[model samples]
Target: MAQPNAQDDFAKLSADLSTLRSDVAKLTETLAAIAKSEGGAAADAITGRLRYGAARAEAAASGLAEEGYAALQDAKARAQALGGDLGATIERNPYGSVLAALGVGFLFGLLSRGR
Candidate 1:
């Protein structure tokens, strides 16, 4: 007996909410179509802006990668041009290399130990 009034209120609220959601969906679709049409300088300006943004992003990414590769190549060239056989240098600098190797090996050992 007491449930009917509460149930009626809940039903009305649900219907109102449902109608509002449908109206918003229709508005979104209408705006999307409008933006697609009406081509002119305004449209061209938008297209140009989008293209410029995409090109700038692409250029930045490529420039960063090229800079990194160039730095690596320069470092390799410097090592080769230092006027000593790399193998002989390693042999002469065995103590330093061995210490570095041991440190690296310890790190790898710890990482693998967890697995």
Candidate 2:
């Protein structure tokens, strides 16, 4: 049996990770936007409590998930600082990054639509 090339395996894994990161960023933006847009007082309070729970979850995440979350938050901050859209990020890296963002947005849309 032939063995897989280690470098190729790593590259594929890295791409998958990048896509996942982008997806999380999109979801974060979508959720934040949704929170801003579709909320009465009760919904606002619920979101606030959910955010509080997120802080606790952050504390519990540990290791790689924590690092991923931190990177996600950084990506989100950068997006918001640049008006929170695709243009800037896409201009920097055309294919992978933008696709990741789209994947994230798609996930967010599906989840939000369900709710």
Model 1 residue runs over 4 Å out of place are 1-39, 78-86, 89-115
lDDT of 2 at 65: 88
Model 1, residue 63: what's the lDDT?
100
Q: Scored by CA lDDT, what does every candidate get?
A: 0.88, 0.87
Q: TM-score for candidate 1, please give it.
A: 0.36
- TM-score of each predicted structure versus truth: 0.36, 0.33
Overall local distance difference test of candidate 1: 0.88
| Candidate 1 clashing pairs, residues 3+ apart or interchain | none
Q: How high is the lDDT of residue 69 in model 1?
A: 100
- How many clashes in each candidate? 0, 1
